[model samples]
Each structure stands twice: as C-alpha cells, then as structure tokens.
Target: MPAITAENQLALPRIERPGPESRPRPAWLVTTARTQLEGEGFQVRRPFPGLEVGIADPFLLLDHIGAVEYAPGEAKGAPWHPHRGFETVTYMIDGALEHHDSTGGGGYIADGATQWMTAGAGILHDEVPPAWLVQKGGLFHGVQLWVNLPASMKWSPPRYQDIGARAVTLLASFDGGALVRLIAGELGGHRGPGVTFTPITLAHVTLAPGTRLETPWRRDFNALVYALNGRGRAGEERRPFGEGQLVVFGNGDHLVVEADELQDARSPNLDVLVLGGRPIREPVVFHGPFVMNSREEIVQAIRDYHAGRMGHIPPTRMDFSHLVGEHIDQDRGGTRR
Candidate 1:
C-alpha cells in the first residue's frame, strides 16, 4: 500500500473523536465484490452498481484495479474512450499510468497520486501504462471512480485536475491507530484537494489490527465503506467484511470501521476507501460511456459523439510549423515544406 504513509502516525494531526451526540451509522447492506476484466484485459473488482443505483447515487461505478503483480508483457490499460456528464477519478497507489485526453490535459499518475477528469460536456479520453512500465512489468494497484453530475452541471465544461500525492490531506485517528488520506471533500474542518460538483468525501484509510475508527459523516450524504484489502468490521452493528467487500451504512452522524486482530500476512492492515456523497435524486440513465438523466439524452450523447461534438484527440506528432525554424514564407506566403 504505497498510498501515502507516515512512519510516526502519532505525530500527525488527529481527527477529533465523534461526540456522544454523533450517532454511528448502522450497517444497512453488505456484499462481496465481483471480479471482471475491464479495459484492455485488465482485471478489476467492482462492488457497486450491482446494488441499487439509488443507494450509490451520485456515484455510478467503482473499479478497484490490481493489487496484482505483473510480469513483463502482461501489463494492460484502458484505450481511447468517450465520456460525458460525469467525473472520473483515478487514484494510483503503487504503479504509474499515463493519461491524455482531447483537452490536452494529462500526465503520469503514480505513487499515491490522483487524476480527476470531469467529462462534463464531453471529451475523448485515453489512459494506459507507460511504455517503460509495460515493458518491465511491476505491481499496480489503483481505484477509478465514476461520479455522476447533476442534470444542471452535466453540460458545464470539461475539466481535469492532477492531484499530486503530496497534495492530499493526511490525518490520523484520535489514538493514532489509523492513517487517513483525504483525497477530496471535507472532513473534520480539513479539506482535500479535489473539487467536486456534487458534495462528497473521499478518503483512504489504513487501520491497524484491533483498532476502531469512528469518524464524523454528513447526514445528507450516503455513506459507503469498501475494503481495499484485509478483513474488518463495519458500522455500529459491526458487520463483518473482508477484501473486495463493500458495506453501505444507514443514515447517521458517524460511521465505524475496526480492523480484525488477525489479518493475513499478505496484507497486514485493513485498507478501506471511505466515501459518501449528496445523492442527486434525479432519474439516472447510464448507457455505455454516457451518464444522463433520460434515455433520449443518452441517445443524443451517442449521436453527438459520433458527429464529433465531443473533443478530438490531438495528433501524436508535434507541429513545428508554428515554431521559429519552420516559418512560413512571407514573400510567397507559401506553406512550409
């Protein structure tokens, strides 16, 4: 788990313990994740969207990509695709990935880094392992989340944010038993680097064995806890869940997660992605790469993509014609050869 860490977690700022008035959310539902091949033959563990869309509202999908080691010539990644009316957040924990899009915004994301792409209106997108990583394969672990945009902001504008590893907010549990990395939204008066159209909170937490994490949560937002690795108990009811499992919490002021005392040596700590968002209670029609409110709107998005209404990918080769050396002829006004 290369996702940011602290040698001395006790030295980090502590998240104030939830007061007595704060009620711990109860475990409403729990399910095991399903493994499937995604994007160019890469495998992913998806835990939601299998549940009711209304339950995970404002969130369309969550794909947990490898914590798997790969040999040379075995690495894979997503190819060119189109998206509209939502945001895609790629958090790279252990390996590198190259991202580029029609908006000319992208770069390498690795080692606890994050790339947030808001395909609001529309955009052509591509993300793949770098040639170096592909040629000499190594471990890769990451998460890609699809966040839905409300109908009002669905066509605002396409934007991209490269949130470096160090930019995330880090905090510790009241007793220093857990390390909290805040990727987006607000928590205990501390805010993350990610900006969102919908109110949300995204955090990666590592809980040491036998430690319980009780954190404040917004009553307005839907709460979900997904285990990235290791076994753990969730909510006030203490529902048992393990790797690739997800827990949905009922409305409350706070939530609880406690790591099991006995964990597999493969992953010694319970690492979980804690997330919640204000539900956009509108009708959701998710078809292919488009997330819209109506079927007709989805149809329109597809037609627009085919008609090139979405942005276009830039040419691979650099254009030196605009540079100093390949200047146009002023006398004849001819094109540079």
Candidate 2:
C-alpha cells in the first residue's frame, strides 16, 4: 500500500511494440486434471506443487491452486522463491494466506480477498498457511495467474494490492445470478478493479441453472473461459464445459454462457473465470520463475538473486535455500537446464 518512489519507478525503460492484433492465441493448452500434490511427501500430487493450466500466450501462466481442504497440523504449501519480468495475481475464494515478500511487503488475505503482486525487476516471496486456519481445517480455494511484463515495465519496482470482496463491483444480474468484476476492463456496463498495465479483463461469475450471461469484449484480444464449478454450455458451438476445464475462444467481441437444466441444481452456482489480453509478439525466453525477451535477461535475473539485489530477506526468517536448491536439482534432472 506504499507509494513507489520516483527513483525506483524510473529504472525501467519504455519500448514501443505491436499490440493484440499482432499476436493471436497460439493453440490453447488443454491440461487435464492431474494431481499436483501427493505421495512423495504430502498427501496431494508430488512433483509439481501447483495446478498449471493454459498456454503462455500474451499471458504466460495461470495456476488454479489450493482449492481443497487442509488437515490439522498437516501443513502444505508453496515456499519462498524468486520471480522476475511478470505479475502474480492471487484471488482467494475461501480460507486465508499469509504472504511475505523480499520487497518488504507482508500481509494476510482472508476469504474473497485478492492480491496482485508485480515482480517487475525481481522479487522473492513466500505464501504459507497460517496456524489458525490449519487448526480449523476447512476449504482453501484460490487462483494464481502470472502475466508477463512488457519490455518497458520489466525493471519497474515491484508492487502489491490486497483487494477485498466488497471493494469489487458486482454488475447486473441474470435471473438472480451475479458477476463480480475484478481487475482492469469492463463487463455488462460495469468496470473492474485495479490498474491497467495491459488491456485485459478478469471476472468471477456465478450463474444459476438455466441462466444465461452475455458480456462484451475487444475483438482483437484472445479470450478464454475457465470453469471453476458446475457444467455449462458456452458460445454458439455449445461446447460442453465442466468443472476444472479451460475453454479458449477464437476472435470475438463477446462471450456467452448458458447453464444446463439436467445438471444438479443443488450446487447450481457455476464459478467461471474469464481472462484475456492483447498478446506480446516478442520472443519469450523462460527459465523457471524468470521470463524475459532474451536468455541474457534470464541470466541477469539469476545473478541478481544470488547477489541479494532483489530486496531484503523475508521477515519470517525462514531459510528457504534448501527447498529452492532441491527444485533446481529436479529441473536439471529433467533436462530443463
């Protein structure tokens, strides 16, 4: 919530480039429901600790994580790590997350809270379950999205936003159904929350059975609908979409969703996340958490991490060096180096 100093903000140099029309959505990456935490140690899928869906289009990564219940004294979550040249957006539906980052920003987000962190030049952060929430033992549902920073904003100072549910505006309803507008852009005559780094739209929608919702969007930007819960039919093709599925659409000015009558109405609420943005045509050189236009920038990010230039160590004082080293080892074993 602190203001970024002029000196720090001026570090990033601007560059002019083509927008959405120049880069369209490559083939949409349809990742199946694979467990990301399990037997190796924790009770969930092993190797990968997060559920990563969607392609690295203009928006590089999207992780629908922590949408399950946690047990007492059984702590499980993501530890401290470094990131550069991208923005991480965390929207929580239930439970709470205690966050601490290298940039001296730390906070706890309750249910329906949203946190947007821009790891511009670079940042090292940690997200862990609080002791109180672990003891209570309830559901932990949320989404984490990573958007690549353009060349101009790559080195800008890191930023953070803890948005509450009340702060977001809900637009007109469809027969008792409703939509919550969050982040940049508009839907159904209602604008969204947060600053506009790029021309983008992020919305959380809930629809009842037999209800239909229509929203306008830019024709040039690539759009996609991710089903969070329930079953529904989208677009003219009437594609059948279920929970935990991503539906990418071709060029269009709007998106539509119609609920199925046969589907169970006991849990008639369908949670669908709509996200799209103008694509970046520049070459994306990715290595683990850092994403840049060139490999040289990736190397510089690594050097910055080792040199302690990102920021001060997290206040929790937890040493995350071992876990990070193990991750690097695994990536190397898989020929990712």
Candidate 3:
C-alpha cells in the first residue's frame, strides 16, 4: 500500500476548517494521560475516552505499558476473562506475553510482534507472562488497544492475527531519521500488516531529533497520538507531548509531528503510536467486557458467557523449561520492528 511521496521534508500548514471548500489541519484537542492498573496486576497509562474526554470512536481504549523491568515473579497479566463486541490488539515492544484463548488459539508475542484478537461474538482469554519469563526475570513492555466493532459485525466469528515482527511493513525517511511501521491501514503509501473490520490506521513511529513527518489520513476519522518515549509536538500549536502522554487531534486530513531536540542523548528520538478511524457514530453500550448497541445486547453477552458458549481453553503443564530462549529478542530497544 505504498502511496506516492515527494521529498522527505515536510511542514504543517495553517489550520483550515473542514467544509465543502477546504480541508484544514487538525488541531490538538487535549492530552489525557493517566496511570492505572489493569488485569491481574500491572500499572499502565490509559488515554482513551472517559468522563473528561470523549471517546475516540472505533477506538474504545488504549493501555500503554511504556517500558518496565520486571523482577522474577513480579509480573502479572490478565487472567481468564470474557470479551465481546470488540477486538483486542496487543503490540509488544519488548518482553514476551503468552496468550491463551477459549477458541484454542494460543501463542506468544515477543519483542516487536503483535497479537490482534477479534472477540466478535464472544470469547474467553487470558494474557499472562510467559511461563519461562515468569520463572526468569526480564523486561515487559507493550500496549493493548481495544477497538470497537460496529453493531452489524458484533456477532461475527472470533478471529486472530499473530503478526510477527518481520511481517510488519517499515517505511523510512530519506535521511533515515524517521521510521514508521504500519500495523493497520496505510501510512504514507505503504500498507500495514494487520487489517481491521472497520477502516482505521495504526502505526508505530520513531523520529530522530529534529525529524519531521506528515501522515495522510481520512478527514472524517478521529485521531490521536500517544507518546511512548522522549518528547514531540503535533499540529500548528506544536503542543508538546511527553512519555505516557496522549494527544488527541481535532480534525484534519494530515497528522504533523516533529521530534524535539532534547539535551539528553540517551533518548535522542521520539517514539509514538498514531491511531485513527472513521467514527462509527452509532449508539454504544459498554458494560465491562461487553460492548453492544443496546443494553439488551450487553445483557445477552453476559448470558452467553455464563452459558459457556465461548469454547474453553485446555490446561497445559506449568513446565516451560524446554521453551526458554525461544521466540524472544533479548534487545527489546527501538520503537518497533
């Protein structure tokens, strides 16, 4: 899905309102980054819709675990849980996470890998540190995004896409100062590896100091940029966003980003994940793990889970000694593959 590109140099034009005559640059709305605990026990920063901030349609939630070193036996993950009417996309920057689902689909996503699970109708799953990693201490870092499914596709068949690090498409700048990994949808002109039921764009971007890039996007889609490391700016105001910060854009067909030149040489670049999608604009009823158009559908989902309709996961022996050192990349640095 490579699109046409001119010189790598880019600039952000003045804001223009979207109308029949012109499509303006989207402005930075607000930043909503907060720390919270999820699943069994893991601290993460969340910035996706709430009482203060409106939900970025199609993207229900985004939980980012920037980078955390885990001591042996200190890491915990999501226990067996049920989900419906949405998909869970897990992109691992470092460390390893073993996922087992009721559909008998189980696997491990190591550094730079991604696991996209569609809990269409319903499914039970558990995301836990690998048995081997739990036994031996290591670092754990990643983000889990919850994507909303339209009412029509809410009951579709559950599916999964285990995208290896190498499967992702990478685009580079002319000077090699910036790299963009397309996870879903097209970035620049390059197509991403994973696909979504609804139209959306998901990309991991890394920019060296003073690097600038503009990503084309749908004018109707809602968008946001999440800073994973270092600092950066977006839009005309050049609103600064730092690690664990989320910057939501107003409306525009292009996303402008520039890496800040900080004094610290250790983090010489900025790492960010850009996400956007055409707003479903449909009624949303979210109840815990279930997301439906109406309260009735949410109740039905709870009933379905309790009725054991979503298959069951088979038990496996706890001995993971034989699997140590498999499918892992020791150097988990860098933005993504």
Best by TM-score: 1
Q: After superposition on all CA atoms, what RMSD does each candidate show versus the true structure?
A: 8.9, 9.4, 8.2
Clash-forming residue pairs, model 3: 1-189, 2-189, 3-189, 16-24
Encode model 2's per-residue lDDT on 49-159: one tens digit a residue: 122332336676555655566777665556666778888787777777788888778678766777888889988777777878768776777777777778998888999
lDDT of all predictions, in order shown? 0.86, 0.63, 0.73
Residue 93 in model 1: lDDT: 89
Candidate 1 residue 26 Cα shift, in angstroms, is 0.4
**Candidate 2 Cα deviation (angstroms), residue 15:** 35
Number of the candidate with higher TM-score, 1 or 3: 1
- Once model 3 is optimally superposed onto the true structure by TM-score, how far is the C-alpha of residue 197 displaced, in angstroms? 0.3
User: Per-residue lDDT of 37-147 in model 1, one digit per residue for the tens?
Assistant: 766578889887889759998898999997989899888876666788999999998989999888899999999999999999998777889888889989999999999
TM-score of 3: 0.84
Question: Which lDDT tens digits does candidate 3 get at residues 99-133?
Answer: 87777886988888899999999887778898777
Segments in model 3 whose C-alpha atoms lie over 4 Å from true places: 1-24, 51-55, 263-266, 317-337
